[model samples]
Target: MVSLDLRRLRFLREFEERGTLGAVATALGYSPSTVSQQLALLEKDVGARLFEKAGRGLRLNDAGHLLAQHARVLLSAAEAAEADLAALGGDIRGTVRAGGLQSAARRLLVPAVARMMAEHPRVRVEVFELELEQALPGLRLGAVDLVIGDEYDGHPRPRPAGLRFTAALEEPIKVVLPAAHPLAGAGRPVPIARLRSDIWTASAEGTGHHAMVVGTCRALGGYEPDLRHRSNDADVQLELVRVGAAVALMPPLALPADDPAIAVRDLAEAALRRRLVTVTRETPPAPALTAFLRAVTDQARNS
Candidate 1:
């Protein structure tokens, strides 16, 4: 095996994405001939065929793909090394953008943001409300710096290429009911089966959360309760419960206050616990992100 360069692997990726060397040169501000020369040097140095011609396009062979994967890791490490060097100086200033699902923003991120602001005054953080899948792609495309997401509704898989994540917390789903409701005041732990008659004010149809709730109810010998209304907002769901419109499923973390209006009933099995994670394409997270995740993780622990 010959000595390979990160620059060459980067070129191959750009070539694959761009589909032409001339376009890669134009985008990279290098002449076409210089791009070709660098690639030739790279190929000779590596001693493996990096790409093959397919009509007017170039595609990576198996070895080239594997090398590209490793190249990404090396380039990321190099970038982090540079950032670490820069951070040794007095001033550490940059923006970290993040996105998460609506529930996380309401129950987790808002407090996390407050703590982050108090601790890291110099760093600006902007958090957006988005679904997990929506946030994951942005983390990959470099559109957002971090994503707070969940894995529930029975999804368990390897992380996508070029991204990393930290497990923040595992929150269980609770059954919410009006305080004066039939099962709320019952002494010896109200049976989960009794929940079927309650009109459930749930999230919209076809979402993972909704599916999970429905699946759990069915599994535990409960009738899929009447879904009178659908909403993603915890506050609104609480209001519906207060008005006796319906009951709602809530995470234990987002349990409503002991209002005469609502009671949170913890479920039976651990299978309903939703795992929340913070993700980034950055090999090493920005300082702001680290601090924020730490605070939220601590909060999650306490909760």
Candidate 2:
């Protein structure tokens, strides 16, 4: 008899994550008494203490830690097997949860979802409008099965511990300005170095793109821009520019759909490309997810 029951393993994982039995019970929709009894049964079968009291809460013992590690893998395998079985049937089918940046969701991801549904009626794809920072954590936690994320110039891409990534699109850095701004209709692209004194809004601090934009400006004979605004939201930053509030820089893919007051211009600075990445766990991408990513990438590339 295996001590590794799915229910017990799930309870242990939930307990470790929640830090209290009450929270675990709430999450699993079970009473505290039932949870305690099940854990006792699991411990008896394993012949080891699974946890020890730590202040007001329980912490996993060494044996529990060991078992917890395997539990994640086992849970993943079970899901993988189910996905495999679904693929074996005629149409690729299953629910796939993906997360990505706002523009990608608005511009690129919804189109992808429509195509996925048309191609496989049985498959369901869910998209979360998220920042890339949130997507990485979710992928690691097995919360999202895939992510459409972007990588910028300076920061290293996360090799999500046990995931593979591929390029979905390459985004170019662009200078966004109000239609009335002097740079809006320039026939030739302006060098970043020449725009030193332009009032500027920037991406939120600490992001790879944010750092790249600042670093590029400094390297190109530009000093720190007169900081007008800082935000992770590209559309908001662009709106600030659209109203002639300030000029902001962004990747072309992140531009808003329509703005009579706004115009996007390519930055001719060398090596200024950013990559959009499709991230998936090391466990093979279920066919439905694969089809969705591939179809979206192709559609986005062509259109």
Top candidate (lDDT) = 2
How accurate locally is residue 210 in candidate 2, as Cα lDDT from 0 to 100?
73
For candidate 1, what is the TM-score? 0.68
In terms of lDDT, model 1 sits at: 0.70
lDDT for model 2 = 0.76
Candidate 1 Cα outliers beyond 4 Å, as residue runs: 1-82, 152-158, 222-225, 268-271
Clashes of each: 0, 0
**Candidate 2 local lDDT, 40-66, one digit each (tens):** 888987888999999987788899989
* lDDT tens readout by residue for model 1, 282-303: 5666555567667777776766
Overall lDDT per candidate, in order of appearance: 0.70, 0.76
lDDT of 1 at 162: 71
Any residue pairs clashing in model 2, and if so which?
none
Taking all chains together, each candidate's TM-score versus the true structure is 0.68, 0.78
